[model samples]
Target: MSQLANIKQNIDTIIGADELMERIRAGKKLRIKLGVDPTRPDLTFGHLVVFNKMKQFQDMGHDCILLIGDYTATIGDPSGRSDTRPVLTEDEVRANAETYLEQAFKILDEDRTIVRYNSEWFNEMSFGDTLNLARKMTVARMLERDDFAKRHASNSPISIVEFLYPLVQGYDSVMLESDVELGGTDQLFNMLVGRQLQKDAGQPEQAVITMPLLVGLDGVKKMSKSYDNYISFNHTAKDMFGRIMSISDETMWDYYRLLLLMDEERIEHHKSDHPMVAKKHLASSLVAMFYSLADAKHELEQFEQVFAKNQRPDDMPEFQWDSLSGGETTCPLLNLMAGTDLFPSKKECRRLVEQGAVKVNDESVSDPKAILDKPADELVIQGGKRKFFKVLG
Candidate 1:
């Protein structure tokens, strides 16, 4: 495929395609803009969907802008909301913005990226300046947005501040003089607003490219931290691999397409293998993206040992026998597991025990208050499916 075609392949929508192609053909070092509001601390595989496309532009010698929406985040993007979003404090936005680049650089080339906080421009605008910008769009034009329209139709309270979000996002493009703008499909309206704002400013309108939202592990909702379905960048290699593996086989194909960017032909080829085999490959590839190949392989091997073979891992986290129990001859099962980092809380550990999810030395233990004899050797304890601990004397 040609360079433009390759970039266009997996993308959901590309407005002003001819302009984008013309600029690419002319060898223009286009300013590609991807604006993200730092509402969440961690960036997930969902963000990777667009970051991959941005990477393509960077590789082709384009100027990729990672715009941090420190100011816009306080308003929050009302793209798909039924209710008004909770406003974020400046401190909260700043703290979230600080971690974005470090995580974003995992996929984007750090040296090549141009990072800018929207606060640079938004912070300087006075209430009078905001009114002048707000005049550019009528309330009718604002309601043209699908989210706004839906809320309006249902008589939902649409805060006037929410109306400014798209305008604020659009002004970023005008300030940057962006050549190409990228976002999720839900942001199409907001991105187009940017394109229109650029046109009105007598600058060339940006080409809007909207990528599909990555489905979360649940396979229903879009990947989001709020939904608790996202696989974030900070997840450990083991957690990443296991979570990817836990996705339904149907959701696996979407992961292959969106996350891996595998074309239909290659995806079909992989579909010929056993689902388990294909899933493992998918899991390892994603784990390897954030971590090393060795980490991926180790996690894959460990997963197979624990889940497939129902055997304990050789490298399970080890704890000194006394470290968990203060050198006692016995320890309460719930207390022992809770003292270690194996479970999140004592209540959860007790629940696992009550539910028979916790096992001691490969034997199922079902009483939360049950006492265990501290083994002189190593006592292997399995906590749920993903956590394993070996207490050593």
Candidate 2:
């Protein structure tokens, strides 16, 4: 295959590839832009799909421009949403941005990355300037987006700010004078908007490339924090390893292809020869990528020991509490679970416990009415198939 063919095979979609290739062949180090809105605190494996592609461009010696949508996030991007997302405060957006870069650096080289905030230009735009910019695109074109059309058809509230999000994002490309832009398939609409804006500004239109979305462990919707189907990068090595193991077998190849960076032929060989071993290898590779090889090995060992041999690991979190003497003080199990962050809310806790999803130590606990007397030495709370926490007093 030609070099361009090889590149195209890996990329899901590319707008104006022939022209972009011409620039690359001319030894031009293109300014590649990748914009991310830090709506959630945790960066999931799904994010790595785009990050890895950016890493590819960086390795090829191009400048990688990371557009931290600190300004755009405040208004919220309504690209694929049917409803307006709650606008994040500047403080909240900044906090999430801090966490975002920290996790992103695990996949991206900080030295090579050009960090930028859209607020640099967007914040400086006057009402008159903003109006002039908004006038560049017609309302008919804006409503052509599937999200906006659906919302309009459904009579859902569509905020004017949401319409401005794409324009603001597109302007980032113009400001940076980007040669290429990278994003997930979901961002195709917003990305194309950037190209159109660049063309209108008389700058060379950026080549837009998008990668496929990574499905979550649920093997359903795209991996996302809103769905609670994500395995966070913020989690410990063991936690990450366990979450990878919990992924549906059907999603193993997608994880292998997108997350593990395994070659296609090798993946096919493993799928045909030894499927179970391939999954274990896939889990180990992913765990190793996020954590060190030593940590990944240790996690694998611990998983085998705990699940296969029914023996706990040596380094589990110890929960300690002073003994409660004499009186029977009762608190709702749901409240206790929520307080400990074992579950997000009382409703979720109650539902899990009632559905026989919660286990106390090794035994299943289905009774929501089960009251706990104070001072239990080792009270283990288990949620679903995997999540477990210990209570000690």
Candidate 3:
């Protein structure tokens, strides 16, 4: 297919496909905008769903703008929230913005891409300016958003700041005069607001393209850091490969299609292979994307050794026994697992132990309160299916 066809291949919807195509054909280097709120420290594969589309435009020689929502992040995007999002301090938002650019560049072209922070304009604006921007949208229009409508119907508390989120986001397009905007389907309302604001400003309205949200490892919820099922771009090669390999066979196909951008024919080609073979290929390909081929290869080898052969990983991380044991002669199994940082919390470690998910030296330890003797030699500990660590006294 042609590059233009490929641009619309996997998108959920495009508001102005014809106009966008006409501009592209007319040799106008369209300014494509993708705005992201740095509410979290890491960008997940879910964010990658839209970034891939942005990269497609960058490759086609359009001016791709990576709009960092440093200003909007303070209010938090209320697109999918049922309640008011917790306000973030300027310091917190700025710090997240720094890391966001680093992770975003993994998929986006750094040299050719144009970067802008909404703070550039928002910081300069006064309360009067915000009120003027707010006049562009009505209260009825703001409540028309699904999330807002649902909240209002359910009598859930909706903050006035939440109502201003779309208007603030919309003002961004007017300021930048974007030609095309890319986002996930959840951001459709906000993107439409941008288009309307652009039209009101007498600038050409931006064509909006919304991509599908990538399902997380659970195969249920959308991939998000809050869901704790996301694979972050900053994850180590081993963690990244292991997490991908752990996804269900059913979910692997989605990853193959969405993350790898494989067409249906290509997906069917992989589906014909044994599920394990297809999954390993998917894992290796994704690991290689953020990291090197050698890193992916090494992780694959370690994965086989640990899971297929039931042997310890060659690169198992080591922790000092004293540190984990807290200088005690014995350490509670739950505490030891939590100290390794493999589990999110001691409560999660306890749950895993009760479910027989924790093992010491390959022996299942089902009791959460079980204690391990401070080992004179290195001891291999496994937490859940994917984590392994060596504790040395």
Candidate 4:
């Protein structure tokens, strides 16, 4: 394939085009850098969007550098936040790093990938060196960033440490002598800083590429743990399938185009011709990518049985009615989910209920105070498109 075609196939966005393509065609092993701050322990589907792109480059014989921003994470990235993030301790960052790698390996090849922590370089920098790095960018330029400008305009707190974040993140590219950098669209401002810093450091400018943000289950904000709209990599196959199924029907095409590895033409045709079938394929494709074909098939079977055939899921969690009833005439669904540990907290359960993502006995339940008066034989409760549990007495 031609170099441009190859680049297009692997990435959704490539900022520096002709020169980067020339480098790729020259048979030079491009050092592709992808940095993820271990702010959250679990890798969500959003992170996988970029990881999948990195996998494409690795498969194409490029060197993939996975930078775990342990050092910079301590400062906390203020990229898109409305408020400053609480800093994480070194121990906390290390603990999250272990799980980050374990989950990242689901898409990234351990042998072929280079996993490095920013602390290795950042820790050794002297106070003088830190000042030199800080001087590489100006406050005026930093203010150009959307988040910074928004915070500044709104009289929101924009700490001096927040300004250091982009510089530190940019230096990661310089340290690796990166040929290309990848991140989500939200990271474009920071990624561009890498290119600028590289140029300022008398190094060849690294190409910047950004992927579209993966919308959460809410189909509004970016998929994030804080928003309670993420599907973690650590979830069981059943949970993963259910989470994918819970996505808004409107998001099916977007997920198919971004998440699944299906042919674009085929997916586009399916979207216009038969959206329902397209979504089924998308859901199955995503499940198969994370799990196996057999597991994906099983999920589809379960989905069909429960959604189409109107039957109970075969492997639902068992709940005791006596334990749930508590002699109360009616119980809030949020309370029920919390008592059963189906959700982490009543807040999340209430959010799920409000979104109309929760159902009981195959019927959508909106009122959190609805009575659970049905016979205790097999009371089915659904969290979203995929999560289901059966209560028995």
Candidate 5:
């Protein structure tokens, strides 16, 4: 694909970018800035939409500036939020920022990426300096943000610190002198704020590119850790493949376009196949990116073994029988599961059993009250597709 066409792929909107294509064709290596709040220790696939775009920029010989929002996260970004977000301490923000880059580097090229922490500058600001920064935006103007407007109209509690979030974020773009800034479409307002801040700071305004929110495995809500519908970049190959497969059939096309970058024609061909077949290909392709082609193939094989063929996994976890039982000849299934720490408590174990998610010796056991005799030789326990343990005497 032409570089111009490639840059436009998977994007939701671009603000003040009428001349962007002309400049890209001119080819003088633009500075692309992207910031992520380190509220959580893990990065989600939702993050990859912009990350992939950054990768595209890097391949075109541009600079990728990754700002870790160590300081902004303390104030909490109020975008798309209805209520005041809980503030984090300096220590909490520092701790959470630790693992972000390890995950980010999974997609971003380390050599071309310029990493910066917002705290690096924020931590050095004097009280007067902060006040000067705060003067950049008025409360009346801040209230113009859609989310803030909604919260105000409904009488929801909006905090004072929340008002400062965009200004601080915008200041990052000014500091970086970025040519372009990237974020999700939900962040269009904040990203545009960065552009105005740059112009006010006597720098060239940065164009904003917003990518669409990747739908979660549920196929309804946006993929987010808070929603528990996210696939973490930290997942093992098999787990990652399985979660990708769990996405609803309707959501497969979105995943194909956003995650796989497959063209429309290729995607239509995938749509012509069985849903499971198409899903497997998606899972394998993603797994290969994060892991390896070898691991992806092996993961698909393992999935087919336990799920498609209804056979036990070759490498089942082992538990010493007498020691695991904690001295009972026969125990309730819940007790056994609890002792293994497979479930948090016997109540949760009973819930899974009653829900028919528990399996023993390759057979589904739906009886929460079922008594499990001590294993004579080997006992297989499976809570779900991902968990399997073997009991041994």
Candidate 6:
């Protein structure tokens, strides 16, 4: 593929493609903007789709402006929200913003990327300035957003503050004088708001490029922590690789197209190959991208050992199993998970059991509430695809 074609790969929409292309042809470095709200401390693979697009711009000799939307996050984005999001305190926003910046370095080059916080200017602006910004967009124009319209038509409680989110987000573009803004397809309206707001401010309007939202491992909803379907960048490399392997064969194509960016020919090549082999290639390649090549290779070896070789890993976590009071053989299933700190909480353990992801002694856990008798020998626990532990009596 040509360079421009490659850059445009997997792009959902580009608001000002011609002008942006013209600028690219001119060989001038453009300032690209991608605003992220730190409503959540961690990013999912869904967010990586946009980050990879920004990485492409950086490679093209353009400047990347990563705007941390500290102020707007407080109001919460109303783009795809069905109901009003809870208001956040300034401290919460700042705390999450810090984590966002720290984790962003995983995909973005620290030296080349310019990070800015909307709170820097939004905090300094007076109420009058905020009011002026709000006047730039009419209520009808704001209603053009699908989510906002649906809520209004359905008579759902649409918080008044929610209306200000896109406007405040748009002001960040004017402040940054962004030449291009990158966002997910869901943010098309907000991104267009940035383009118009910049022009209204007598600045060069930013071109908007939106990428497709990556589907989670569930192969349905968008990848997100709230859905419990997200693959977190914070997961262990082995866990990350294992989760990739769990995705359905069809969903792997979505992963390749959106996250992996394999061309049509290469993707078809994978389809002709064995599904397991293709998935391993995709899994290890993704692991290498997020972590390292060595870690990816080691993880692949571990996966093959457990699944193909039918053997426990050489390095499994060990947990001590104490007999119940009075030498009783039975123990609460939740107690073993909790006592060992195998799970963060009883709730998570219950959830895993309900999902049929928790197993003890190679048997599927029929009941999270069931008490298990003490094993005569070493007990093995396998939770989810990656978590494994050995219990010693």
- Indicate which candidate wins on lDDT: 1
C-alpha lDDT (0 to 100) for residue 369 of candidate 3: 76
Report the C-alpha lDDT of model 6 over 220-314, residue by residue, as the tens digit. 98888877788877778877898899999999998887778788899999999999999999999989988899999999999998889866666
- Ranked candidates, highest TM-score first: 3, 5, 2, 6, 1, 4
Per-prediction TM-score:
0.91, 0.92, 0.98, 0.88, 0.93, 0.91
Report the lDDT of model 2 for residue 92.
Answer: 93
**Candidate 2 vs 4: which has more lDDT:** 4
**TM-score of structure candidate 1:** 0.91
Candidate 6 lands at a TM-score of: 0.91
Q: What is the C-alpha RMSD of each candidate to the true structure, in Å?
A: 2.6, 2.5, 1.1, 3.3, 2.2, 2.8
Give the alpha-carbon lDDT of every model: 0.91, 0.82, 0.90, 0.84, 0.86, 0.85
Superposed by TM-score, candidate 4 places the C-alpha of residue 324 at a distance from the truth, in angstroms, of 6.2
What is candidate 6's CA lDDT for residue 71? 86
Q: Lowest lDDT 10-mer window, candidate 3?
A: 1-10
Residue by residue across 109-217, what tens digits does model 2's lDDT show?
9999999999999889899999998998888998888989999999999888888888888889999999999998878888898999999999999999999989987
lDDT of 1: 0.91
- State the lDDT of candidate 5 residue by residue for 1-393, as single tens digits: 777787789899987676676667687678999999999888889998889888988888888999999989989989899888888888888877878888999898998899999888888999899899888888889889999999999999988788888888999998898989999988987888898888888987888999999999888999988887989899878679888988999998898898888889999999999999999999999999999999999989988998899877787567776666677788777777777875557787888888999999879999988888887787899986667888875
Which stretches in model 6 have alpha-carbon errors above 4 Å?
1-3, 322-330, 338-359, 363-378
- Between candidates 2 and 5, the one scoring higher on lDDT is 5
Per-residue C-alpha lDDT of model 3 across residues 18-129, encoded as one tens digit per residue? 8888987888999989999999899999988888889888888889999999999999898888888888998999999999999999998899989999989998999999
